[model samples]
Structure formats: C-alpha cells, structure tokens
Target: MDAVSKENEVRLRKGTSLNERLVLAGIAVILCLIALPGLAHLANGQWLGIAALFALLFGCLLLGAALFERNVVWIITPGEILIGEQRPFGKLHRRLIRDDEVSGMRLRKSIGKSVEFTLVFETESKDTLTSPPLPDITQVRKTTLQIAWLLQLPAPELAENPLDAANPRIRLGKPISFKRVRAYRALVVLLACSLSLPFIYALWSGKLSALGIAVWSLGAIMAFVLIRYLYRTSAFWIVHDGAIRFERLSLKGTTETDTVSGDDVEAIDVESGGRKDSLYVITIRLRTGKKIRSPPLAGKDQTHAVQAEIIRRLRLNSSGDA
Candidate 1:
C-alpha cells in the first residue's frame, strides 16, 4: 500500500502483494499435483476421479482469481473523490463522490484485539462510502486528515476507543427492527439440516445399527441446542420514557423484555461477537457492572445506530433527572 500527494490531488493505491500472489500460486500448483492421481482414475469411472475433477477445477479457479485481482485506487481532488479498481486491461469498478455531497469523514475501527481502521465518508443523505482497510491507525489518521483538509471538511478526531466512535443516526425515538434476524435463523436451520445429510443417507441405506442411531440422535440434539441458543425468532429495540427496552419474540410466541433505566446505564456501545467476531451486537453497561447485549445485529451500521440512540436517550434522561 502507498499514497502519493501532488500539488492538486492525493492518490492512494493498494493491491495484493507479490509475496502473497506467489504463495497462492504455490498452493494452486500443489492442489493440481494432488489431483493428478485422482484424475487418472477417471478412466475407470471411480468416485475418486469425480472428487479429483472438483479439486482441479478449484485450483484453476483460485489461480485465475488471483491473476485477475484488481488494484484499488483512490484519487481525491478538490471537487470530487474517485475510487476505482484497476485491472491490467481497464478499471473494473469506479465510484465518484462530489465534495458538496460529503458531510464528513469518520474513522471506524473494527472490534477485536487486531483492530483494523477504515475511513468512511458520511454523505449528506446519511449514506456512507468506505475506503479499503488501512494498514495502521497512524496512516489512516494522516490520510483522513489530509483528505479533510483538501476538501475543506472537518478533520475527524481519533476515537478514544472503538466504542466512543459509535454515532447514532439523526432519527431517534423510533423502533429499530431486526427483520433480518428471522432470515438468519432460517439459514442456520438449513445449514444444520445440510450437515445431517450424511447421517440421513447412512440410515436410509440400512447401514446404521443401534449405536449409529444413538450417535445421530445426539448430534441432532446438539445442533438444535446450538441453533436455539444463537438466534431468536425476532427482536427490536426502542427508547421510551428515559429507558431503553429490548424485546425478543421466541419461537414459542413468548415475548421477553429487558429494560435498563437511564439511571442505571453506564454506557452503550457496539461489540463484535459470534463465530470469529464476524457479527456485531449492542451492549449496555450498567452502573452495577452488569452488561446486557442484544442479538447479533444485521450489520455494523445498524448496531452503531442502536448504540447511539440508546446513549442519546440515556443522556436526555439524565439531564431531565438533574
């Protein structure tokens, strides 16, 4: 990754490094070699030959994708910001943001020990245009400040912590729904069923004994328990009368409500959780040191919005109490 600045413009470029490309190429070659014996069995119509075919195809696909990977370039001018993905032949994707349309720049950090910072452009319409993951906080801060200076925009301050950067949407005092939670639950169930296909096949083939039945039953029960624990049927959050309430509807059509009063609330922030920290959730810290968290939200933006709104309402209530 490198950035260049000229009299009238600044340009940032990033792409797959040569060493990474070489490593990928080496892996592809190994995969192809491993598939060679399986390919030879194709003449005898063996199942191994079918598996080999898939392996060879996958290797080729990986190699091709690496070769065609595009270099990301961001060109910032006084009038507009242009972001594009450049291939050897031409630009693959291009986006332009006019200066007038941009409200400000935000430095967003992912939630994890190995944190990544991304510079996001907040538009007048509340939409965000994000940059590629930056290498370090120092570089990202410098880059964001430079762009802000060039555009005559406010230089974004570095968040004291990831939670401090959480900003609520302008629209508050409304219900925030997690409609996608249901779809996510459905997908989990589908995946669990897909994983059980091998056991079902064995049972259908009459190869399972009493022991096999017990094993399958145990596996199914575990999967059900995990899925039930991970997801709720539906959920939403609302701020009303100086408190934030989280309501969850279960599969059994029972509604559970968890409300934290503004007086007891310490802080509201978004945190990453679930499966390698790929999902974000809203966490509320109480004065007593207990933490309440919502289900994995639909996306980081939504989670932050909820966090912001809850914090905003808490502040409003605190002022009222005073």
Candidate 2:
C-alpha cells in the first residue's frame, strides 16, 4: 500500500455526521427562502416559494437522518486528506499529495487573519486545493502539524499563551495597540486614500461643486468614515498570559482565559516584511489548523522580540537542533 493508503488505514475514522449534514442543508434552505422574494416576480413568486419549501423539507429529512443514523460515518476516509464539511450539501474536498512534488509545510496567514498552515508542494500544474471550512479547533490545528511533519516541513514559530490553554472558555485580554492595524488597516488606509483622491481633486480643480458648504461637509464625512473604517479593520488582536491585548496600543486589559491545554498547540510562525524599517508579523498556528496573524503595525522591536520568544519556545519543545 502507498503511504497515504497506509496512513488512512491507521488514522481514518468515520468522521462524517448526519446531523452536520442536516444543519448544512437547513442553512441552505434558509438562504433559498431569503432569495425567493427576489425571484418571486418571475413566476408570480409561487414557484420560488414552492422550491424553497421543498428545500426546507429536504433539509428536515436530512437532519432527521443525521440525528438517528449511526452506521453512516460523519468523516469519510479518502486515500488523501479531505475536509468533510459539516453542512449537509457539502461534498468531500479532496487533497492529492504526490511523493516527489512535496515541499515543507509552513504556517502562514492569508487576507483577513484566516490563519492556516499550508503544505507546500511544487507541481507543474498550478491548481490548488483548499480543505472545506474546518469542523473544530483541535482537529484543524492537529491536521496542520501532522501534514507539515509528514512532509518534513519546519513548524511555524507560534506564540504560546499558557493562560489561553488553561482557560479557553474565557475571553483572554488583548493588546490595545495601534500596531495591531498593520496588516488589514494598512490596506484600508490605502484604499481610502485611493478613493478620496479623485473626489479631492474634483473639489480642488473646480470641476465639481465647490458650491455650498455641503461640499466641504460631505468631504469631511467621507474622510471620517474612511478613517473609522480603517480603525476598525486594524483591530486584529492576540491574547497572551492573562491579558487580552491590541497590537498598536500598550495597555493590557484583563479577560477570562480559555480552558484549552497548552499542549494542544500545533504550530506557530513569525513573519516580518520589508528590510529597512521592517515591520514584524506574528502568526500563531493553532491546534485547530486555524492560523491567526497579528497585524504588522504593532512596532518592529516588539514583534521581533515576540518572534524570538516564540522561536525559543518552539525550539525548546522541538526535538531537532536549532
């Protein structure tokens, strides 16, 4: 048997659940009903409503099957790793890994802090496969590490917050720092500036209304809204020790910690961009396979130190020499 098939024999469990499918179907039905009104005029709305009702009934049946079915496994074992979506309509998301095409897995962040550890592999074809939305936190994290290790990839350096593992149920404190806005807020600011430019030029060149004071007032409102939106987008945060903290601000506030054990963490990585005046970006790959990246705006020194600390911890825990 191939390695994948062997691994499947050892680790594959019936992971799928009927209840999960029912839930997905139910959600889909709800969406369909929501769209029924918009399409109602096409068939006097009768067909749309009937279609939505049928969908809802089908969802209920699937839910019922999920609630009572035991022989049906929630998770299916494909030769390769596939993410079984919790929703009913979800099909198996297959992942195909080739032996020679494999590269080391690394934990990285994508847009909007959707933290994930990606298995790096080189293939002649540029197609990519992403697992469906993960089912749970622990499973996701565990999967990231397992896949990385299997491919002989360096585990991403992730920060450990003992308090988070000790008390996952409670909300841990976040750093209230401006540096937190580094990643997302920076994008927002750039977009805002881009949007405001034409408008500002229009006002300045007298091409549009410099008419009443409303022009200036409207300009101010637009600027304010853009600034505020940028602020909100910059709100990426992380929890450490006993505090919930924001990256840009220096103040540490108290919050309840979660109950997850520290040993549960799977992978962590720190990344920084730019050489001169480089910004620090810290990414925590959780046991759930979900990764979170702290925004770069948090200041260079602080991020570097945090990265070092995380690397130190990972090195200590790791069996290989640093």
Across 1-322, the per-residue lDDT of candidate 1 in tens digits comes to: 6567665788877777777877887898899889988998898999999999999999998787667777898888887889898764565799888989998887787755444567788899999887775543324455666678777788887754322223231222123334555566677779878877878898899887788889879888887776675446355665554666677756554567777778887667678867545568767778888987665654464455456555565773422221
Across 112-219, the per-residue lDDT of candidate 2 in tens digits comes to: 332222333343465444332222222334554555454455564432422222333222124344555445556765766776677778767877664634655676
lDDT score of model 2?
0.44
**Which stretches of candidate 2 lie above 4 Å from their native place?**
1-20, 23-113, 118-218, 225-322
Candidate 2, run of 10 with poorest lDDT: 1-10
RMSD (Å) per prediction? 11.1, 14.1
Task: Point to the candidate with the largest TM-score.
Answer: 1
